[model samples]
Target: MSKKTLLSEIKEKIDQLVNAGFNNPTQIAKRIHRDLSIDETERTINHTRGTVKYHIHQSKKRKSNPALAQACQERGINFDNVGIAWNKDKHWSIQFRPSETGPTFEEMLQDHIDAIKNHNFKYEKIRRQNYSLPCLLVIDPADIHVGKLASSFETGEDYNTQIAVQRVKEGVDGILQKASGFNIEKIVFVAGNDILHIDTPKRVTTSGTPQDTDGMWYDNFLIAKRLYVDILDKLVKIADVHVMYNPSNHDYTNGFFLADAIKSWYRTCKNISFDVSIAHRKYFKYGTSLIGTTHGDGAKQQDLPLLMAQESKKMWSDTKHRYVYIHHIHHKVSKDYHGVTVEALRSPSSADSWHHRNGYQHSPKAIEGFVHSKDNGQIARFTHLF
Candidate 1:
């Protein structure tokens, strides 16, 4: 057999494994290695992971877009045999060749947009019954990672879209239940900050490198959008809702999409408001207490307070009690920067293989919230650990 023919065979196997959602190089190698070992005719071949990666590149083909793989998977269609090309103009589309009759990337994109467009949110005008002490209920759903996947064997913890959704639901329920006694006047629903597991259709971060994902980007976006809707519905019944979005490292672009969609969803709802702009740093005022939120990927911990003051001078001066909520580090961190309090919220998200293998483990998965009083400021705190 010619060397070129052998290379072609190896490339074909790589394409098959990649289209089946084996993105990691090591995982792909193991997958194809088993294939070579099982087939009697190919039993004599000795190939490593590095060689497989080389063949993938040499074949002038890359891994199939996760979005296309997911759409095909849903329809019980194998994307391995389908011809796909990556179009980067808009939101990374998988342009398919005319031969295979399948869902076009454009159609999938339109499906999500249509879902957002046709959403009819029936917001019943809800007014809180007989309130007493006034306080702000800040529910920070830190690092939700809605579509993240974690293997128990690889990460020592099991997590997926279902687990993520469950944890968020459980966490939010616990916080609200615990805060039931407080006369919460304002519900500050702090969101974004990596609520999604992936930004691009290629299952990568904003920087364009592949990452482990539980589902397709569009599917996950819809799920997360629904989750936020349910959450806001509950919160609005309690008090006026104020939605804020802080762009995160993983899903900055998609996060904005979710945030804006929520804003549009609550357009008719009088009590609901939004701070869903592109700024990574965002500020909110609850009487005298000033609050700032950011994804915490760009700036240093110590620098946040200074940045906050510099960015919003008028708010910093007017408010007596100033606090900043930063998310990215998946554990609890509280540091008093003298006049300003800089804190990082804890995450309920279980680490994936990459995080677990690299000692990114933090135990006692939980959600945290704080109650800020007008006169006293941050008078109470709540945490629900899973």
Candidate 2:
């Protein structure tokens, strides 16, 4: 690229950053580092800061450089990707790119305001036969916490057994509504770990202190099994179902329990298919795509991607793309790592005051959703349902 062209590109990137709502120099520096893979040395960091300052200074001056000024006027750049690197307090850096990739900040902001509108518009545009494809519904009924008293930690308002069941049923209904709207032909029900309150037969507090329950552990198990069966039967009526029972920290025996029940149930009901296993494991074919799911309790949060990568390498070497969907965090996080997409699905429960007390919050209300594979199974897109 010529010097003039290069300067124009950099100027456009800076302008984009400013327009994307990034004003801090440190943020701009980080974006540059990510986009260009620039070294984070003092010199390079200082250079990025100086570049942003100079551009702003020039724009304020209304300089005679017509090319630079014109590039700034176009202002087609998006700065949401811009980021900053900080060291302690004194040192800082900025990074940004010249063009928009993925969704722009403004687009995302607007999406939050009118998700249904945006979704409808996009759906209408792509509703033609050529784009119509069979969608898969991945249902995750996570952390039921049966037999536990619902306190402030679980919900903003105190919930008795009846209220909790009602809330769960509402979530299930919402999921079914969303799935019906989509052209979904199959359902992957991932029964998350912690299907019960206590991990073992012993009663316990939320913090795992020893306690007692009114009924036997077997009673709790039966209650959980009955509820799950009811939910599965309802879903099977809507679509062909494949249930994956993942054992969790609270209910270490849930996987085995679900597996046995499903095995016996399948003998009686020929329509609903079933696949059950322990959590934190390998991939399975959902359609033409390979999907890996877990309850997300085995490894540290930061190490999950590495664990999934190693597992996917061995289990899905032939697959074009690999996805690992996890529950437990009760928040949504989608990121690409080591040629695999890792997604943390949000929970449908309103009871999560512990998260609120810790100062964590996000919009559209935390929901349960599914990952739809696209690009001939090379990419996965998460669509929030409930």
Candidate 3:
């Protein structure tokens, strides 16, 4: 084969793999190497990982918008993300994000507007039912780690993006089924407690700690977004839902962005409310029961009771029963303090390389839920084990 033909074929292969979701250069290189074993082609181009990366960049540059690409080049900004959405109206929306330069305030606002416009959330107003035995149901699927990877051979349990999604759905269904006997007036869906495994494409946490990841960072973000949307959609049918966000160490920045995206998604819904702020601890009061939520990485467990009381002084004074649900340790620890009960929830994600190596194993992986009476505080606890 000719040298020109070999190079063209190499570029084609690279494009095909990238479109098929193998975005990493090393992954594409291995796949192409397995498919094409021609000696002449190997000698002509030598499709190493670096060569694959070059071809991928060239391909992306060719497909990018000329004016926008030029502006990014002038600003020394690298395109960090590219996405395509196909609407039911047969229209396509293409988007890309600049890593270094990022977007202006106006552009960010426009993106949020576009997100709402692209998809129609036909949410009809859900009527509230008068329940004789009213209670607040708290569904805290803590430490999901949606993009974390764990091989059964290494960690004694297999985990990936698919497993993470499945386990959450099953766990939520299980909790709802268990709580079906009670009249659920309101739901506090605890979100953003390390829902994503990584914050950056470099396979690292927000603080730059390296991690073993499963899917691409963007894919995991979308997966978590869809998961939250689906859960909220279902919860709203049963009762009025309140989404509480708890910013965690891992995926701290991305987690906030995800919560905002979810907030935008359900902007039209009347039955769902959100507390997607960047607060380290979030408090919600239902009747005489006041519940606090935190990711629990920064503040110590013993100090949580005083912090809750200090932070939400009005709620603390008004409510008779108080509880703070915390996550991050992936194990169970419950302590009743002077006026509050601080409980660290369990996680559904299995141990990855770091956790497995450090002897963090066998803590009964499960998703937990709590049923709180109007004046009696937390009455029932639901556990869905893996």
Best by lDDT: 3
All predictions: root-mean-square deviation over Cα? 14.7, 23.9, 13.6
TM-score of each model, in listed order: 0.72, 0.54, 0.74
Which lDDT tens digits does candidate 1 get at residues 1-386?
56577556667888888778765555666676676554535532234455654555433332335665666678897555655545456666556642332233454455455545556757667767655678999999899998898998887789998898888888999999999888888989898999998887678988886788987677788799889988888888888988889998899888887888788778889889899999989999888899999989988989988888899999888888999999898988889997889998889999987888899896668899999988778988999998
Per-residue error at 93 for model 1, in Å? 28
lDDT: the better of candidates 1 and 2: 1
lDDT, candidate 2, equals 0.57
- The weakest ten consecutive residues by lDDT in model 3 span 80-89
Local distance difference test values of all predictions, in order = 0.80, 0.57, 0.84
Deviation in Å, model 3, residue 202 alpha carbon: 0.6
Residue-wise C-alpha lDDT for candidate 3, range 154-249, written one tens digit per residue = 988899999999999999999999999999999999999999999887789999999999977766876898899889888999999999999999
lDDT of 2 at 29: 58
Candidate 1 accuracy as TM-score: 0.72
Q: Which candidate number maximizes TM-score?
A: 3
Runs in model 3 lying further than 4 Å from the true structure: 1-58, 61-115
TM-score of 2: 0.54
lDDT of 2 by residue, 1-386 (tens): 45466456667888888889876555675586566555555236556655775575445444433443355557753222222212232565534222212233343233233322222221111122332676667766565556555355444545334444555667777767765656666678777456666644446543465632334454455566666767866876766677776666666654465455545544445556666655456456754467777778776556766675566565455666667777766667778876667777765444444545565644333336564544355322333333
